[model samples]
Target: MSSAQQEEEVLGKAYDGRLMGRLLAYVRPYRWQVVVATLAAGLHSVTQVVGPYLNKVIIDRYLFPTHAPGSHSLIGNYLPADPWRGIASVALLYITMLVIGFALDFLQTWSMQWVGQHSMYDLRRDLFHHLQRLQISFFDRNPVGRMVTRVTNDVEMINDMISSALVAFFDDSFVLLLIIVVMFRFNWKLSLITLAVLPFMILATRAFRRAVRDSYRRIRVAVARINVFLQEHVTGMSVVQAFNREQRAYDEFDQINRVHLRAWTDAVFAYALYYPAIEFLSTLAIALILWFGGLRVLNHT
Candidate 1:
């Protein structure tokens, strides 16, 4: 990681840890809801595991049964007496899991949002009360727009990631771990091959995240500079026209506009490169899974 990314990581983790500790304290008043939400998340993860297992079972027993040919009633073979029945059962099982997963998803979402927003509302009230406690010099040093961005945009971002994305990420990671365990149980060789690509993908994600974050920060700065320029010009429009300084205003705008354009172009190029690289790597992993697993299945090895 770059030094900038390392610094960001450190700061982010520290802020997140502190905020979450405070947020968790809010659950004392809604302990039952929090418990229910936790259970809902667990159920969602279980559904994720069951969905893939159902697919495996359907493929093995219904779509391409190993013993179907010799399963004649007179042959006394123990293969499914009616493969269609098995398929129907699997279909029902899948649908049931889907419904359960969706319901749990909704419950988790609603509960987490309620808890998060409630805590944030209380926190904002406190912040406002504290803001009243600050001296006038604090207001003088911090621009109103900048302070608003911190209290509004920055706080909202924190709420979004912590309340929603954080829980969802935890649920996803649990599901992912369960999937890996089951996948390896199904076929360890294929699991190993598929997992070998994971590290590279994670590294690429980290690199792309840093690049995109820095690029977008630059874009925002450029946009802000342009806005400041426009604000000044518009505020002084009458004086400019009276002094016949239209040419000077145009020149200033052109310079700011060029900066904005460069910022946008650089951001676009960065994203273009980042997305295609990730897509290429993901595609390569899928192809390898198909090719290698197909061979292994055919060889019964």
Candidate 2:
């Protein structure tokens, strides 16, 4: 059997409190940067609604007669007759918001990435130090290939979660919360109807997460097997030739490669199913909005 077929020792959990606490400990040193990045993400989240809300204000005031005269306005007074100045001012403010959001997004990305890189660097260094302190029997028990994976691929996965996924998680969460706030703020009935699809979406997401996790695990195992097979075969090439085992070695490698291909294909299928599923649900939401929300607009309710 290929090394990739070996049983994995590090099993991941859906929600591991101890694991999360340890991860947070690694991030504690850079808590200030994390805070600033979060604040910037929040600013970007709040600013995201500005353009749409501004459009609503402009349409209600200048384009449509949805409200009475002298209602809420960005300027001193909102006169339906004199909407040009108000419209121009609102547009300018909208443009300003876009600019500010751009700056905030840049800062947020940079700050989080900085924190992530530094934290991962420390983690990688620690991993290397720990490996250096291991006994010779440890080396004899574990293959060189598996040890290499520990210091490289596995560490890279942790780095990705710490540096990219963690920040992205917050960014996405804030965006979702802001979307809920904006949807209800604009139209509660439409929002409720649109959100009716959320429970299904969440369920689909949960299934996708579990499936993807298994697929990814299979992929990692397959990759490790291939790496171990290659490393051992290449190092023992002379012995294989002396024993006329080239054909056998080639066959084994082909088998390992096929297993790797199958593993990655499963991952691809998981991704394919998840994204299109989300898009289908999103389309359903939009269809509901157009059907019901359209009626509300037409009836002027």
Candidate 3:
């Protein structure tokens, strides 16, 4: 493997505070936008939880009305007693929540993307300036493709982290926290039973992360190799043609392209397994909830 490939293959710490701090520095100028995006993400998560809660309320109070007629809570008192009217009101509320969720989602996505683009612009500008000031020996030591990758692909990855990954992390955390609270509030025993599969889920997630990490490293290395190979060969096309090396060059490129294809295939396979594993665990949790909760209901517990 070439030096560039070796460098790309060396995976660093997943979460380095120093690196994160440096990245955040670029985001400092757009702090307000970040705050807005964060808030929007949180609100969107609330909407997600609220949608399910609304469904439960509709079923319990309006559809079935299993509880005593006069025992309705303050919020329930506001709801129409007539089933059809209550359904209409709840349905309207559900639609309103959907619209609000859509707006929040749009705001979060737009603001983060705006921040990401601006941050990347600043980073790329600074990187180019730094490259310009470096000694001639610096250029000699680094391949053009590697430097190009740093300026383009690597910076784009940082943009993606800012625009998608970080926001998603926050949104998911909020959603999970809300779900746990809601679950425990509704039925502590059932919640405990539902969470019993959490350990297995965690283990599966760890394994999935490891597999994906390895695949990502391989993909990065393959990308660098492809860049290096193309830069060298394409630039010397005249020389290659004169020496009748077109077929050889094509064969070499084919090999490098195959490496990239295999790397992507591995990534796809990992994702396929990871999602199904998570879904299976979720199904198991739901099954357990039904079995245990049904017994409680039958026993009038």
Candidate 4:
């Protein structure tokens, strides 16, 4: 590995609030887009909660009419006596919510993409400008490939985090919270039972993330090594041919290629393990919901 690659092997903290705050500095100029994205996400979250609720209402009020319009009925006085009318009304609202949610989600996605592209453009321009001002010694110490990767790969990763991961994280959190709230509001006991697997799922997800991260880190190192090898070899191809060292160069390249392949294999293994684990956990959760929530349905609880 190059000295630059070795230096990058030092794994730092995954999150740094101050670093994130600094990143937001770039978005400050495009606050309007952020605001619109936030609004769209917020609207989307509300629809996520409300849409499911409409289905629940359909099941409880229209399909079964558990408690027919009577003195004890909660909405008997306000809603139409005909259950079909009530179902149609709620279904209309559900469709409306779905349409709005789709539009808002699309808007948020497009807006974030725009923000990411623009922000990265500025960031890369500034990065190149700063690199131009750096001392010659710094360039001498770092491989040209590593420097180029900083401008392209590393910056692109950061842009993805900012535009996609960060925003989605917040929106998903809100949607999850809303789901939990709605679930408990509908049936506290059933919600509690369904949520029992959450801790185990969380643990499994954390383990998966750690494993994949380590594997991908190895892959990055391997890829960087490959990049450095290619850059140096291509740049010095004449020197090797002059010395009649083609066989030696080929052997070295073969060795480096194998290392890169092994790293990629490890990453693929991690990915293969993670996704099935997630699918299994998801199926397990569904099974649990059916087993327990089915009991609630039978008992009319």
- What local lDDT does model 3 show for residue 12? 94
Query: lDDT for each of the candidates?
Result: 0.71, 0.81, 0.88, 0.79
- Ordered list by lDDT, greatest first: 3, 2, 4, 1
Q: Which stretches of candidate 4 lie over 4 Å from their true place?
A: 68-87, 296-301
What lDDT tens digits, residue by residue, belong to model 4 across residues 150-202?
78877888899778986798689879888888677656777777777778778
Query: What is the TM-score of each predicted model, taking all chains together?
Result: 0.74, 0.90, 0.94, 0.87
State in Å the error of residue 101, model 2: 1.2
Error of 3 at 74 (Å): 5.9
Model 1 stretches with alpha carbons more than 4 Å out: 1-35, 67-80, 216-271
The residue-level lDDT of candidate 3 at 50 comes to 89
Evaluate model 2: give its TM-score. 0.90
Specify the highest-lDDT model's number.
3
Model 2, CA-based lDDT = 0.81
Q: Give the TM-score ranking, best first.
A: 3, 2, 4, 1
Clashes of 4: 0
lDDT by residue for model 3 over 163-221, one digit each (tens)? Answer: 99987998899899999998887778899999999999999999999989888888877
Residue 217's lDDT in candidate 2: 84
Better of 2 and 4 by lDDT: 2
Off by more than 4 A, model 2: 1-11, 68-81
Between the candidate structures 1 and 4, which one is better when assessed by TM-score?
4
Clashes counted in candidate 2 amount to: 2
Pairs in steric clash, model 4: none
